[model samples]
Target: MLVRTFGWSFAITVAGLAFAGVLWGWQGLAVVAILSVLEISLSFDNAVINAGILRKLNAFWQKIFLTVGVLIAVFGMRLVFPVVIVAITAKIGPIEAVKVAVNDPDRYQHLVTSAHPAIAAFGGVFLLMIFLDFLFEDRDLHWLAWLERPLAKVGKLDTLSVIVALVALLVTATTVATSVPLQGGGTADKSATVLLAGVAGLVTYLVVGGVSGFFEGRLEEDGDEAAADADGAEETAPARRGGASALGLAGKAAFFMFLYLEVIDASFSFDGVIGAFAITNDIFMMALGLGIGAMYIRSLTVFLVRKGTLDDYVYLEHGAHYAIGALAVILLVTIKHEVNEVVTGLVGVVLILASFLSSVVRNRRLGEGSEQLEEQAEIPSGV
Candidate 1:
């Protein structure tokens, strides 16, 4: 299963490194290695979330995710997205952005970095919504039951997550003092850019998530609605497998999920694209390295689905959403402070590993309890 899932990714990794070596020698190899590691570490939560959604998609959609979806993930996000940002923020044409990326990468990097307050606000809020919406919605299984249970109760209010995100965004605005220059010479107030970008994020989430949720079929599939269900049934509410309840809405559902997935990937890419400048300013090298890492992530998502990791490691999704929540906060805080990529990566790893271990324990106890019950049932009442 592992080999079949990752076969092409392995081949791509070899070709990627060899190509990097041919283009820029050993330094290129080292940079690619560093950037690839950086991308992987930063985006592991993305893989888990991707898997959760991918499992609900039909095989045809999964193929699209692997093929066309990969193209969008790599080139669209890692490559074109940054250039477009540079172009938009700098008021330069695409051609000019391309020239700058190739000829004067340092300037291009600075331009991109300067625009990060807005990027942080946008990515941060969008990710926060994803995390908050997960936690706030009703769920039967709680990794941190003490806190999550209360939040789920409060989630009875439809706008709670959005309200919280806005509050956080407003607070972030207070801390920003420097103004980032806009493309047309007039400066955009740092606070204003952050505010508007964040608002944009919120809107995007509403639109995309709304579209995805509209076509959703069954009540059990609604993880967010799980809180409203009775406790007893919560445990038995099975995760509907790939393309369940399509009945005939499969194509429409798949399209929305596809769009939803792309938007999620784009959100994940914001920080990585900005952070890549810290390693190197050359856009192509950065894209190649990061793209290689992205391919592995996509492959990993597929592996998790094929291996049934989501079902086996039940709490993994909970942990992943928590990591995303942490990341969202980190992204927002970055507007007021400088944070290490390593720190961000470490936090996610810790949350996810903790969750993974917890799942193992739960699974073990459940198995033992089932066995004990079976043995007791076998014994005669007189015995």
Candidate 2:
């Protein structure tokens, strides 16, 4: 399973290294290697969260995610999107941005870093919404029952997640974003930019989530109607719904879900892109390295879904979300203070590992209890 899933990742790694070596020698190769490791470590939780969403789509859409989705991830997000950001932030054309990235890498890096206040605000708010929504949701299982149970109860209030996220954005903007130092060595007031970016992020989440949810609800309604028809009820609407309408609804749901996943990936990549400058200012090398890591992450998502890993380890999703919450806070904090990528990566890795270990222990306990009950039942019958 490992080979089958990671074969392309390995292949890409080698090719990317070869390309980097040809262009910029051993130093380029080393930087790409470091960036790849950085991306994977930081995004392990993202793979878990993605698996939770990807499993809902059928086989065809899953294929689309692996194929078309990766292109959007690698080229669109890693390459073009960064260029676009630089263009807008630097007030240059796309062509000029590319030239700047190639010829004046230090300047390009400066431009990208200059835009970090807004980027952090947007990504932070979007990720915070994801974490908050998951935290407030009522689930059949809870990893942190003491905390989650209370949050779930409070979540019954409409738009609670939105309200909380907005408040967080406002506070962070007023405090942290306002204190971020400018290139000229004085603090820059970025409160308005942060607020605007944060609102854009929040609205994007709502619109994408709403569209996906609407289609998913439609699919569920169709399913319930089909089940009723199977149970010998009048097959009035379902009989008409199955052929084309059902397929259309499924397609729509998958498409929107795919969009949601891409946006999530983009949010996860924001810091990685900005942080890449610390290692290498060459944008193409950054793309090659991060792109390789992204392919592996996508493959990991596929492996989790196919192996039913989430089902086996129930708390994995909860841990991923908690890690996301941590990341959101980190992004907001970084608006005023510098954070090491190592710290970001380690926090996620630790959360995921802790949850995995907890799941194993829980499974062992459940097995032991079942065995005890079986032995007691047999003894009582004999006695």
Candidate 3:
């Protein structure tokens, strides 16, 4: 199953590394390899989060995510997205931005780095919303029951997540954004920019999430109606295979979910794109490395879905959201201070590993309890 899932990723990795080596020799190959590892490490939580959403999609939509979605992730986000950001932030044309990226990479890197404040604000807020909603929402299972129980009670209040997110943005803008020092001289007041970007991020999350939810709700209604008329018929093959809902998302619902997934990917990629400059300023190399990582992530998401990993390791989703929350905080902090990519990757990996262990322990306890119950049942009442 592992080899079948990652076969394409392996093929692409070999081809991409070969291209890098032929063009720029061993250094290029090495950087690409490093960047690929870096991307996979940093975005492991992203793969988990994606699996949670991707499972809701049917076979057709899942294929679209692996194929067409990969194109957008690799070329669109990893390559063209940076160029577009440099163009907008540096006040240059698309052609000029491409030239700068190819001919004068140092300047290009500077431009990309300079845009970090805005990028961080937007991505930070967007990701915060995701984490906040997850943390607050009521669920039967709670990984961190001590904290999550209280948060779920508070979640009863309408729009609590949005309110908390806005307050955080306001405080951050007033303090951290205002104190960011410029490369040339005195500290620059980026509070306004931060607020604008943060609001944009907030609105984007609302619009996408709201629209997707609306479609999903409609689909659920339709499914309920259809089920009512079926006279207790057996579940469909797609329903049994995917198992996200009684009916897998298709048509409009799936389309919007795909859009939401793309936006989430864009938010996650923001920091990685900027951080890649620290390794190498060659745009093509960054794209190749990150693209390989993206493909692997896609493969992993599909594998998790097929194997029903989320169903088995229930705490995995909780840990992924906690990692996301930590990352959002880190991105906000990085608006003023630099954060090492290793630190970012380590936090995610540690959280996920911890959660996996917790799940294993829980499973053991449940197994023992069931065994005790079975022993009692087997014993005769008088004996």
Candidate 4:
């Protein structure tokens, strides 16, 4: 199953490298490959988060994520998003922007860097809200249930999230409006743009997230029936096969899964798109490198889901959420100053690795404790 799932990814990577080599020569391929590795390293947390959502998806959506989703990531965001940014900020036609980028790479780099502050503010606050929402939510195994309970009961976190997002939007607006002469003399009206982007991000989160939560809650409410159906279906299915049903309400599960996957993908892409500025200004190169990187991230997401690594590792998803929290704060900090992409990637890799190691240590300790209990039982109760 792993081989079959990853076969396309391997083939695509080889073909993409070959194409990149022909287009930009060996140097470009080498740079893109390096960037891809860097992006993958940085987004390991994203893969774990994605695994949690992907597990709920039907096979069809999973295929869409692997196939059509690659096109959206590689071409849509990596390629088109930059052009869109340039057009909006520079007040130039996208074709002209592309031409300028191709003609004067240095100038294009300047334009992208100039826009970084606003991008940072937008991505930062959006992610921060996400982190806070997850951290404060009432989850079953929450370590600090005492704290979470009071917070969840004080009113819906969703309402609080909206309030926080609104505050962030106002703050971002005030800053962008008041600040004079951003890095370049580029006098683009960024307040409106930043405000719009923030609202869009918040709305996307609420609509997609709220709907998914509603459906998941409903599924849990109908737990016995769903469990019986799942068991019966499993009995009739092949042992090693993928097993998500498209039956009746399960379709809601699939829709919610799709929405959640897209939202998570958007969140993961934030840094990659921003960091591409440091690499090259040629929207083409930036897109190609980052797009290729996104492909691998998506592939990694599918790989984790297929392998049931999330179920096995248990704490891996928790670790990724915590990492997302960290990344969100780092992004918010980047609004006022530079945060190197290398540093961003390294932090994520270290945090995730640390979490994995902690989980292993925890599992081992539990095993030891269990063994000790068993031995004590064997010894006799009085002794």
Candidate 5:
């Protein structure tokens, strides 16, 4: 399973490195290597979250994710995304943006960096909503009871996550600590633009999530009926899942899951596009490095889904969501403050590791308790 999951990933890695080596020889290769490491490190939590979603997708969608999805990750988000951003922000044609990126990478980097405030606002709010939505749900299993329980209570309010995200976006725009002057306008113009982009992100999340929920409801009703016919018994698990659930494979749920995965990738890419500047200003190199890293992350997601890693480490999802919340804050804060990519990446890594450790301890306790219960049962309760 591991080999099957990561086989193409290894191939992509080699191809990415070779692409870099051809572009700038050994120097480019080294930069791609470093960027790849940075991307994988920062995105490990993203992979975990993705695995939770991906396992719900069917075999066809799973194959689409590994194939078409990776192409989008590699070329779409890494290469074209920055150029598109620059083109929009700088009010230049796409051709001009591409030319500038290829011929004058430093200037391209400047344009991309200058647009970071808006980018951060969009990605930050989107990610924060994801984390908040997960926490706000009334789930039996609580990882951070002190906080999540209260959040769940508050979540009883309709569209609370959307409200909070809007408030956060407003606060971010207003309290950006020394307004950023626009290209040909005042700080107010830039702030308004940033707020609009942030709102766009919020809207995108709602539409996508709503679409997912719609399809989920449809599939769920069908699954419940199927389960009922099979045994005339209550659906033991969520109706959203299937028999291949142990494999994390979803039937029709794959479509929505794939859409969600792409949105999630776009959210992750905001930081990647920004962080690429710290390493190399070359757009092609950034794509090669970050794109390859994305492939690996996707591979990891598949591996985790296939191997039942999430089932084994139940609390891992909580940790990943928490890391996402932290990242959202970091992105919002970055509007005025320059944050280190290492710091950003390390925050996620620590949260995930901590959760993994907690899961390990919980697993051990559960195992021991089960053993004790079995022993007592064997001895006969009345005696």
Candidate 6:
């Protein structure tokens, strides 16, 4: 299963390196590989979160995620997005920016570095909203009527998320608008922009999310009666929903998975994208390096899902979410200043590892308790 799921990933990895080799010879391939590994390591939490979503997706959607989704991630987000950002913010002609990125690498790096405040602010605030929403929201899955009442109340409370998102958006807009006139030595303005950008990101999440939910609800309603009839015929059956089942929870899950994955990917890429300024400015190289890293992260997500790692380490999911929350805060705090990518990576790594170890300890104790209970049962109750 792992091989089938991730087979294309390895192909893409090799192909990406080969392309890098063509561009800058052996040294380029080495650099790309190192960067790719770094991204994969830093993004372990992302993979776990993605797995939670993947397990809920149908196979067809999963395939789409691996294929089309990857293209959007590697090319659209990592490559084109950065260049587009530089073009719009720097007032440089798009063509000139691309040319500068390709030919005059050093100058390109400077442009990207200069634009770091905006980029960090955009990614930082967007991720902050995501983390906050997940952490504070009441998310309890109930399977009974008694539970439904409380759950309904929680559902209504979703308005809080919307309200918070709106406020953040307003602040972000105000900051960006005011900061425009105060370029250079504009720490206050930059800080305002960062805060506003985070708000803008929250707004984007709410809007895009609402659209996705609307369509998903319509799809589910259409499929409901057919599913009910199908369920009646299979009393002794294993509750098989088959392909339709895939379309059910799985499809919805996949869509959200896509959203979450994209958000996390965007978060992790902020530093690499910003740090690329330290390398050559050639937008191509920047894109190439970042794209390579993205591919590996995607591949890692697939590997985790196919291998059932989440099932094995149930706490892994919790840990990743916690790490994402921490990273979001770090990004927000460092908006106007420099924060080492290594530090960012280390923080996430430590949080996730701690979570994993804790999960292991908890599971071990549970297993031992179960074993003792079984032994007691075998000996006879009264004895």
Better of 3 and 4 by TM-score: 3
TM values, all candidates: 0.89, 0.97, 0.95, 0.82, 0.90, 0.79
Local error of candidate 5 at 141, Å? Answer: 0.6
**lDDT per residue, candidate 2, 245-270, as tens digits?**
77788889999999999999999999
Supply the TM-score for candidate 4. 0.82
lDDT of each: 0.86, 0.91, 0.91, 0.71, 0.85, 0.65
Question: Which of the predicted structures, 3 or 4, would earn the higher lDDT when compared with the native?
Answer: 3
Q: Of the candidates numbered 1 and 6, which has the greater TM-score value? A: 1
Q: Give the TM-score of candidate 5.
A: 0.90
Q: What is candidate 1's lDDT per residue for 1-383, written digit by digit as tens?
A: 88888898889889999999999999998999899999999989899999999998888999999999999999999999889889998999999999998998878987888788889999999999999999998988888899999999999999999999999888888665244445446545598888999999999999988977777654334434444343435444342332233334666777888999888888888888888888899999999999988988999999899889989999999999999999999888877577899999899889999999999999999999999999999999998
Error of 1 at 334 (Å): 1.0
Model 1 Cα shift for residue 92 (angstroms): 0.9
lDDT of 1 at 344: 91
**lDDT per residue, candidate 3, 86-172, as tens digits?**
999989999999999999988888888888899999999999999999999999999999999999999988799999999999999
Q: Which scores greater on lDDT, model 1 or model 4?
A: 1
How many residue pairs clash (N, CA or C atoms closer than 3 angstroms) in each of the candidate models, in the order given?
A: 3, 0, 0, 0, 3, 5
Worst 10 residues of 2 by lDDT: 235-244
TM-score of the candidate numbered 2?
A: 0.97
Flag clash pairs in model 1. Answer: 138-224, 138-227, 139-227
Question: What is candidate 3's local distance difference test score?
Answer: 0.91
- Candidate 1: C-alpha RMSD after superposition: 6.5
RMSD of 2: 1.5
Give candidates' CA RMSD values in order.
Answer: 6.5, 1.5, 3.6, 5.0, 4.6, 5.6
